[model samples]
Target: MKEKHTWLDAVWRILLYFWALTIVFPLCWVLYESLKTNPEFYQDIWALPKQLNWQNYADAWTDYGFGKSLLNTLYYVGGTLIVSLFFTTINAYALTRMEFKGRNLIWGLIMLSLFLPGVNALVPQYVVMRELGLTNSIPGLILLSGLGESVFYLMLLGGFMRSLPKELEESAIMDGASLFQKFWRVIVPLSTPGIVTVAVFKFLGYYNNFMGPFIYLSDPEKYPIAVQMYSANKQMEYTADWVTLFAGVAISMVPSIIIYMLFQRLLMEGATMGAVKG
Candidate 1:
């Protein structure tokens, strides 16, 4: 049994190493390519650069408008994070813990909506945005996304909230904690792992979101990194500045990597919060 278990573990380890290579290799290749000039890149696609062309990054940053787009993205993403986290936490707490009329029914309806295709709502959403005069503005986009409830976030947070002991809330109540106090003080603090997990996931999604911003934001100044990179890539078809494009692509990946590295522990803890029994 021990021998078999050891062999199984070895196989899993090998697979994991291969998977890591698949992800890391492309990222390293992009970083390497970003360091080359056009002539060096054209001379040898696979070979290392003759000299590090740091100018490509500078050109990508200023010429490609990554600086402005990055700022816009930070504004959009930061606002959405604050608003969505607050609302989602409240909604999850109410759905999972607070007993009220039609709570299950509401949850059931929300779950049922999951079966419907989201693409179908694009037209109506666009129309509403137009009517509300929200198109082409970052704050408008923030409100649109933040106000929208995500089923996946709800489910992840609800599961974590459900796993908390009712005794904690009872203790808070005995001490005369009000409804908002119970949630803001007792629940929010306890659910930090789950909230952080949701935050990291949402950050990735918001950062990479292309279609929403692309459809709504027509101004180049308002573009997020994803949309900006895409526009730059299209321009590359004519200008053929592949190295600079690579540089922008590499720069665009930095935030996601940093966010994942920082919050990875909390993310892992939150992921398993519901599975482990107290």
Candidate 2:
């Protein structure tokens, strides 16, 4: 039987629609603005463009140095994802699945750290990076991000790992599989959904990270898209090329949009599974 819609349900639906419009309207506005000329944009910020100026995209790509920044972002995001995911998976597996001394103590420490403010570590992190001579380089940024494991991801994956059937590892052990073999062959494949969820969240965080790059890097050429876009904003004060800047902003949004579109289903599935398991 179809459930009857109540007044509360109608109110929730209206609020959800309003929230969706709040997000979608700005994106649609920015996209069209990127395709307009400066005169058209200046004449009416809210009006639709009469003609799409494709040249704005070209100008943003070439003149504004977004092309190089795009490549740098890809490299940084990819490397950090690979390194961080590897460590996070291993750490989660060991903490959740394996029997080891001091494991509970270590986990408790990690959980406790979650309550601590991350900003407290910034000065010490910078000093360590400076001492290692790793500041202002792409590898330095990658190392910093990769080594600093996210407590949330660790817990998320750990919870998922705990939900896995113990029999799988038991069978592997009976078959004379080593500890590494059990983890690799039995656990890793089953935990893929959880891993992908963590990856998506991490990708967004690392891709859009501005503070690390801005504080650690001084060279313009080494800047990622976030910093490069920020620099572009500063330059916009003099150039006054608002449309090209809008184009650049649109370009920066593309990768994140694509990632979400492609993996939206898996993300939902993963989150649902994690919630159920927790």
Which candidate number maximizes lDDT?
2
Write model 2 residue lDDT over 1-278, tens digit each, in one string.
98899999999999999999999999999999999999999999999999999899999999999989999999999999999999999999999998989999999899899899988988999999999999989999999999898789998889889999999999999999999999899899999889889999999999999999899999988889999999999998899999999999999999999999988988887788987996
TM-score of 2: 0.97
Pairs clashing in candidate 1? Answer: none
Cα RMSDs, all models = 1.7, 1.0
Task: Please give, for residues 201-273, the per-residue lDDT of candidate 1 as tens digits.
Answer: 8898899988899999999999999999999999987999999999999989988999989988999999788
- Model 1 poorest 10 in a row by lDDT: 269-278
Q: lDDT per model, in order?
A: 0.92, 0.93
State model 1's lDDT.
0.92
| Model 2 misplaced regions, further than 4 Å | none
